[model samples]
Target chain A: MAEKHNIKNPAVKRILQEVKEMQSNPSDDYMSLPLEENIFEWQFAIRGPRDTEFEGGIYHGRIQLPSEYPFKPPSFMLLTPSGRFETQTKICLSISNHHPEHWQPSWSVRTALVALIAFMPTNPNGALGSLNYKKEDRCALATKSQEAPPKFGTPERQRLIDEIHEYMLSKSSPLPQLAPSQASEEQSKTEEAKAQVNLENPEALPVGAEIPDQAGDRIVEEQELPVNANPNPAGVEASMESSSSVSSNQLLQKSDARVQNLKPDTRVQKPDDRLFTLAAIGLAIAIVVLLLKKFIKSTEYGAVFMDES
Target chain B: MKFCKKYQEYMQGQEKKLPGVGFKKLKKILKKCRRNSSSQKPLHASLAAKTCPDHCPVCDGTFFPSLLNEMSDIVGCFNQRAQKLLELHLASGVRKYFLWIKGKLQGNHTALIQEGKDLVTYALINAIAIRKILKKYDKIHYSKQGQLFKSQIQSMHKEILQSPWLCELMAFHINLRETKVKSRKAHALFDGCSLTFKDGKPALTCELFDSIKVDIDLTCSICLDTVFDPVSLTCGHIFCYICACSAASVSIVNGLKSADPKMKCPLCREGAVYEGAVHLEELNILLSRSCQEYWEQRIQTERVERVKQIKEHWDSQCRAFVGV
Candidate 1:
């Protein structure tokens, strides 16, 4: 109720409504919010699309809305150190204010964000606020993007960005567990559902329309979505982070051994010596056992002769 | 809810083996979701066994219940909007395509570059509407199917923008609102450019402003940018002429013609390439009209590359034949 009162301006109210809508049905690709002081100025971040040069990258940017927003287009500038767009410069885009004829009242911030993510990989072609970086440079910047704080937005916005990035990384680590094996299971389940529905009506599963990912992954996602499920997402993230680090440490150890092999002095050179010594000791024990067995057999024959006399 | 029930009944009937016609297959089996489900579609209230032409009722069905139903009208409204835009695109596109094809075959240079810009307004509107509808569907139903629909609709959108026959449709381009060039050959700059840098490197240096914000979603995948001299391959993937030629190892002199009819597309290498690829007229018009200087430079570059490729091919063949 208090939140509704805070937004007295009609345009501000509309912007607030959009924020609420986005929160309820958050996109997997990006997230955005207006600032506390000014609803017109929004901060946004997007996950670069998978399989592209921008993959695994988190790009941060700002959108400045006019007083007559839907009537007028917004201007955008990327603040993050993305190799694609220049920081602190208003970029020209069809959705951006550079083209008023192209702007329609129907387009919202959501549309703008989708277009922004999609545009990141395209050649800049000498466009304003556009960057044409080499793939390797962009890739290197992408790795840096994981930790680079917001250089342009406020401190609060930067904190939100960090939290969201942490969430994304933690979410991705658990995703590989669901890939090929579960996809096949989903295919079979779909077929089974179809067959069953043909005979009778669909039960609708009592589960909402969610496309159930692999069984375990789906549960984890559900648990993560609710408000009080964890109460502290940061804690869950920390544990997942530590587990991932331990696995990586094991991999690093394997690489370390190979690296040691390059230095003649540091190398553990006698790897086969223990195995050869063990084999020799086992051979000697077998010979002693054979001799003992022969002696026992001769003693038994002599005792038999004394009994016969 | 009522629509869901009727759809279920219809689907069951179709899947059933009609006891009379066991092995004598006569009727066409309309599989569900053949047309991408997420693309905007109209509700027809068809009593044709309550089943849509395709099977998936949620995405394609016309008869879902409406009491306390928030999404039915929203989806219907989006479908209407999309249908209107698509109709405009088809009407303008078909006429221009035929004219361009005639112009190409008859050697009419004037007609080839002539102004026939099909507007991108409807396409943009359709995109926004589709995005909203997909979001609404997800919000109401909480389904993962919405995610799948998104990619399906996105691919469909790309196909629409890169259609070979359609020409440029300028949207929100402020500079081109009143500006008109007299000659067809003179490429009028319809947009403005901005320059900026990052991290002391030549970072984010190139940015252009045009009629409207050109959604990167509509851009071609191969060029990592706008579809220039856009060509629609047999495999449904679109690319610039120079890019496609290089990918197929065919020079612009010989064009996309292949003796082996089996040359594969670079993107979907499994699909065999078509000899005569379709050029997107409107995209070329957009490229030339808005970015005239860049377009002219590209033409010069292509011409030089074609000459080099042709000469190289002949030299290699001749040397091999001569046992050198």
Candidate 2:
């Protein structure tokens, strides 16, 4: 099979060299090999960087080498759903084909895979095919990334992807702290929901409810709810910690059935608040006009009296 | 005179065989020393009681230590000479880079060629010496200690062939072939010296004689190719920098420097060798100069890779500070 590529092409020679090297010094972090049929297309899997959301994740991707490879960088597309990158789309990276200007001939599939791992933790900064999924969601995807190799292309390609995923599973660390934190994560979500209810109808809630939240906290939670929720799971964690601290107190309170009914009440309050601000501004403008009119009328009367004198 | 010369030659042959004369006797002598030391009798006193054999003047204890001392001496001198030659070449290269000297003295290609040749000769001679001594040791002692010592020196990075400077010298010779093309006469010194591939392994083959070709292995054990931007780890293994960096830490953005101190070499498995990795700039220059198109492409690619690295580094730093 190897002798089939006995041609004198430099790219083929380089790929063969890399294949031999990759076999000799196999890395635990990644495994890559060109297809048996087409030496230009490679399937690879990378172990996510440790201590990161992607840790314990085995991400599978495809590499399409140009005929002038090493000179021209290879194009990369993730086959697995890593929250960091959209699946089956060409990802833009300094080490990938999207940035040919940055591709080094000395860099092989090995270095690129390593770079991919390093890039896992970095901000996408809105690069093409990048996704800013929440850390929790990313962690979830990371776990899911290990479950099975992505289904793509031919049976051979699928087999290759499966083989790489298997290699990565054996190499990557066990699924991270995500497993243990899952129960607590769910508990926190329910607590947040209960807190939202309390926020909606603070007047209806008993004084002994022990929500312990200030008006400022309520305003922040309301403002940060929908827009920043996915991007900033850390904010959710911070709120979780505070909620957990007062959890024992809230556990003794009545069931949250009555709190659910008051969900619409908070929605009603937002527009009322806006209207109140508008009315206050209107009153201030009316008072200023009245004062100016009185002063002008008095001044005109004084001028007439002076002329008569 | 003819008879005397024949007799002298006959004596020399007998003398060569004399070292192996008392292997059993030496073992017995060592056992006596050990027994004496164990029983509280002085070791020398016990040995002094027995007449020393003609073939083995010194006991095994003193002979092995002295043999080791001789071995170290050979290695130490070779190391010093290699370092001095490398320093000379590097200093000249540096001065040339800075344009310190005026014309007539500015280009020292001849001097470099001579130094490179000398370094290669020194390495070859010293390596031969080590091999001859080890063979002699095994012959005398009827043991594999010489072979063991050879491997021990290799692991210790004390083997003369393992020196990074020798690779630089080869590069200089290979590069000189290109630069000295106009001076056909000077090219004679570097004739038939070039990098070649044999069975997928890269080697520097220099043909000094029609029958005497010296092959210096240049294949990066990691990449299985003629090293591109070769870096010598403290373990004395030469690998392409990119290969070593990937080996050390696939996820580290800072290349080899950010590698864990305890990370081991892929070839020798020697730990903590990556930190002091020396990038052989002279060898890199030689490779690039000798191969124009390949070098140009590599240079462009490297420049872009560097730019991307710098960009990534700054982006990460900015992210840290700006909390974005």
Candidate 3:
């Protein structure tokens, strides 16, 4: 009753309201419930995002609020089989006010939970209160979690879960899903695009066309065949004599336009894609300039000879 | 008249009972009353039962005679000199008995399960006192006990070093001294083999190292990055304190930054960042170093960049004003 008495305090009230908001509009991956009798004590269940080792596994944990309420942070203990956190161990987290100065009382239970869910999948290089398990072990544990019974098997645990489930179900917006497989696919695609752009000038490919190698090979071959066959002695000489000076001037103007657009894209796109695009654009400009330079040099030579004659 | 008045009242109350009772009836009533009273132990007798044994199995005799003899002897030995000797003898016996019991319980094990520094210190003091007494009495030579005492002292020292509170105290000492002299920018520096950046800054979580690499330990992996609002990866790896801020995407509409469904770990090619990431505390020590460095560097870079930008802007303005 004394514990319940403090629930009306501003800090506790704010956290409770936040929890209510989280439940009403549950994140796609996790849900949490505060104890009705004791608002400070909360239980959380998170559904691992699809494609992750913990995908489909539900993790349960306890959040113990400090008696000082929001002034001091809460502590966490995991009760379920999570690959990251050790089962039934209180994990020391920065946001939990375990590290006093780091805690932001403005950060509610929802903030802590959201941060927690998002931090999964990182390498636990120097973390305290983090458990190290083999990938296989983690995956196995995650799979086995489905069959693992809840520790709080009493009416209380069931009621809490039911309440959370109902709340999550009622929510129109789902928690953001961190589907690892999908992310990997997206990452791979970006990487592939980057590799292609790096290897060949992205600017060489006409806008919205396939990469230059795949798109322009047929056109390039067709042009090459005609040039190879047309070794005409007299007609070539006549054309070279007349139009050589004009073509050299046009080549110079085209290269100047390319030089202007060579600046990197400052737009806030994904880092990897942006880098790739920049590299591709640079290469494409370089190739175009080089080709134009050769054409202009040959034309200028012919024009000089015609002037001398 | 007062006595006669009381006698009259007693006689009046006893009027329902026979004044001249039969012997058989009186004897039966007396036996019943005796049996009823004997069923329960008297309070005083029960209290005495604790210290005084009712029967002596060794002598096959009641305790009455021995108790009487002991009481008389105790009274006789009440003189100051005799009482002091008796007290010393009793104390010696108690000490010897305790020592024997402790020896049996401890067997060959000298290690004590000391949960706290205070308890360890107390044990060490007691051991020292015992050693001194043993030597004073010529019960055991100093050489014979020296090694054992030394080992116990060393163990206590090791425990103190291992204790986090003690380490923190030591850090405080170092910090205070260092700050006074102004030797280094920070009190201590944390180093780690790897780093994770959130929002291009470092986040500290020491626990992450425990899970990932056992051999190569780090104080903080994400050093040099200023982790403003730190978040942890599910694997317990902490990153730019604020990096998770964006990854979780806390919004006014969303209430708090919940992990994006599509979030992946920045370090490991595998695993999602948002599924079960937590902020790690142990890594904070390392982050402190990184944060300090990051801020210092940021300031330096920003100053230079600002100057260059201002100069360029002025130059461009001059050119435009001159119609270049």
Docking quality level of the chain pair in candidate 2: incorrect
Docking class of 3: incorrect
Identify the runs in model 2 with alpha carbons over 4 angstroms from their true place. A1-309, B1-64, B67-81, B91-94, B97-112, B177-193, B199-201, B207-214, B221-225, B250-258, B321-324
Model 2 captures what fraction of native contacts? 0.04
What is the TM-score (0 to 1) of candidate 1?
0.31
Q: Flag the better candidate by DockQ, 2 or 3.
A: 2
Prediction 3 TM-score vs. true: 0.27
Q: Per-residue alpha-carbon lDDT of model 2 for B1-324, expressed as tens digits?
A: 332233233324431221112233334545564444446545565456443333443434564555456556655665565566556556643353344243246666565565566446545544554465556555544457668767876776667666666666666655554444343232232345566544334466766322345676656654345567888888777777766776675323676777898777776667788887877766776555444444454456456556665787789889999999
> Model 2 over residues A71-180: C-alpha lDDT tens digits?
67899999888889999899999988888755555578888888998898999999999999999998999888877778999997777677666655654433212235
The Cα error of candidate 3 at residue B297, in Å, is 50
DockQ comparisons of all candidates to the true complex: 0.01, 0.02, 0.01
Q: Provide the lDDT at B207 for model 1.
A: 20
Ranking by TM-score: 2, 1, 3
TM-score for each candidate, following the candidate numbering: 0.31, 0.42, 0.27
Best by TM-score: 2
Cα lDDT of candidate 2 equals 0.59
Residues A177-244, model 3: lDDT tens digits: 33469887777777666644532331232212221232112111111113322221111110000111
